[model samples]
Target: MATLLHIDSSALPQGSASRDVTAVFRKTWEEQHPEGTVVYRDLAANPLPHISATALSVGSVDPAEFTAEQRAAHDLRVELAEELERADAVLIGTPMYNFTIPSSLKAWLDQVIIMGRTAGEKPSAAGTPVTVVASRGGSYAPGTPRESFEFVTTYLEKVLTGMLGLEVDFIVPELTLAATVPAMAELVGKSEASRAKADEEAVTKAKALVARLAG
Candidate 1:
């Protein structure tokens, strides 16, 4: 049976744009693969420890020579990597935070991105498709003044594709704060439209992805 690794990192548990879209995608996926497995991780609720010297250094040393602390750290890293490697697909929901991904997601990346394993020439999870629901408070697409400041999709595309060799696709819901943020109040209509489109894409993409995998 297929397995999907679903991860959510939005700090806002409620009314999270990315989370909403990801939920739609996952629901569609579940409908298609009723017997499939889903491994879910709520990064904000249970944040992973950031990479430490011991964890990073353990990769370079011989496993037989690892100290007690280093061995423990290495084991955690191995577990995370193995979980990723076994996935048929991945789903990540992340709201743009400070123009980038949240610290929780970054910490998970650091822990899972070990050289010669998940990040090397022959990445263990290579060719796995990862769909990212990248929601943002404001428009930052090309031609926007803040385009250069947009880092969430660009960074993730590089890390998930370039480094990890995963196939990355994005469903962006921009201007997510229009309904609540005073500065973006005028864009409420646009935000709603964006969210609607994202939801539509989530369903379409999820169905198409499942079909492609089944093929």
Candidate 2:
């Protein structure tokens, strides 16, 4: 059976749009592939440290000459890379923070996107595929007025496609601010309703995809 790696990076566990939607996706996926194993990593609650300069330094020093800290960092990076390499599929749940992916998620990326593992050795080799399920409060898809504010999805797509050679797929639920306040309250209501509906549809679609892939 295939193993699925589910990484959730939203700080808000209960009310996070990204987490909530990802939960739905995972539920549908589990139903379709009940025998598959899942490894969950919550980056927001248990954040990984940023990569250090020592980890990047290359030298001719013998293995016994390496400092303890350097060895520890290298081991952590190797562990993260191994988890990603072993998974048949990876699902990342991210919410746009300051118009881009959160720092926690970026740190995780630094650990897993290792050279000679995920990518970077060959100039033209096809890389592993990853799907990101992202949630945002505003509309950022193409043709929307806020489309210009779509750096989050575009940046991820570019990095995954160009650097890692991953076939990237995105599920974005937008217009989240359409309901609660005095300004655009009605719009917010409509958008929230739309997003709720989309959440269900996305879950169904994700399940079907998983079934097809696993079978």
Candidate 3:
């Protein structure tokens, strides 16, 4: 059975837009692949530390001559790398904060996107596959005025597709309800309707992709 890594980076519990959308995707994914296993990681609740200077320097020195700090860092990186390599699929819930991916999410990325492990220097190869489910509270799709202001989606696509060589898939639900006050009121009034619509759309796309993957 395939394993799916579900990563949630939002600090907000029930009210987080990213988590809310991710939940929808996860439910749909589980329904489609009842035999698949899921490993959930809540970065907000249990945050990962930033890479230390010791961690980087450890690679320069021989492992036999490494200090305690260097060994600890190496162990952490190894553990993180193993989790990523073992998973068949990854589902990341990311929100735009200050027009970029969340710091917690970035930290998680640092742990997983390791050199000579998750990616790097493989001659003959079929690349890995990764899917990201991004949620934001603004209209930033192409042709929209705020599209250029979006760094989150573009950066992720470049890193995952261009750098890591993963077949990247993304679901971006435009949360336009928060665009204006009256709209916000209406959104609160019919939040379930909005969520349901977004969920339906995401589920349809995700299921199709999964079927292709299984085939």
Candidate 4:
């Protein structure tokens, strides 16, 4: 059976635009692949440990020479990397926090990105398709006032594709706080439009991914 590695890093689970859109994608994906497996991680609910000195040294350490602490940390890193290696596709739901990804998400990445495994020239999961739902509170696309602050997608695109060698696709829902933030009231319509487009794109992308996998 095919497997989907789904991760959600939003602290605000109920109202997060990224979570909502990822749910759409996952729902459509499961419908298309009824026998598929889903390995889910809710980072905000159960955050991963940041990479420690031991975890960072896992790739070079002689397994026979590991200390108890080092061995445990290395094992965790291997487990996380192996999960990625086993997946057919990856889905990430990340909301912008201070113009970048959440610390929880970063922690997960740290644990999983072991050199010679997930991040090297021959990344274990290289070429796996990954779709990211990146939700932002305000407009940060090119030509927008905050365009220069758009780090979430740009940074992820580089890291996922450049470093991990994953095939990356992004669905961004901008101006997510427009309806609730008083100063963004004028852009509520645009926010709604962006959300609608994101939801539609989520389904389309999920179907396309299924088709690609099947073919």
On lDDT, the candidate that comes out on top is: 1
By TM-score, the candidates rank as 4, 1, 2, 3
lDDT tens digits by residue: candidate 3, 19-52: 8777877888888888988899999999988876
Kindly give the number of clashing pairs for every candidate. Answer: 0, 4, 0, 0
Error of 4 at 110 (Å): 1.5
What's model 4's TM-score?
A: 0.97
- Cα misplacement distance, residue 192 of candidate 1 (Å): 0.2
Cα miss at 13, model 4 (Å)? 2.1
Candidate 4 — which residues are off by over 4 angstroms? none
Off by over 4 Å in 3: 123-126, 176-197
Q: Where is model 4 poorest over a 10-residue stretch in terms of lDDT?
A: 51-60
lDDT of 2 by residue, 1-215 (tens): 87778899988878777888778878887888899888999999899998678665522346677788777777787788778777777788998887889899999887666666566855232454466878787777779887887778888888777776766777787766556546766677667776777687668766766876767
lDDT tens digits, residue span 61-121, model 4 = 7899989999899888888888899999999999999999999999988888877778887
Question: Pairing residues by index, what is the TM-score of model 2?
Answer: 0.89
Off by over 4 Å in 1: none
RMSD of each: 1.0, 2.4, 3.0, 0.9
Better of 2 and 3 by lDDT: 2
lDDT of 2: 0.76
Candidate 4 or 1, higher lDDT: 1
Residue lDDT tens for model 1, 125-197 = 9999999999999999999999999999999999999889999999999999899899888899999999999
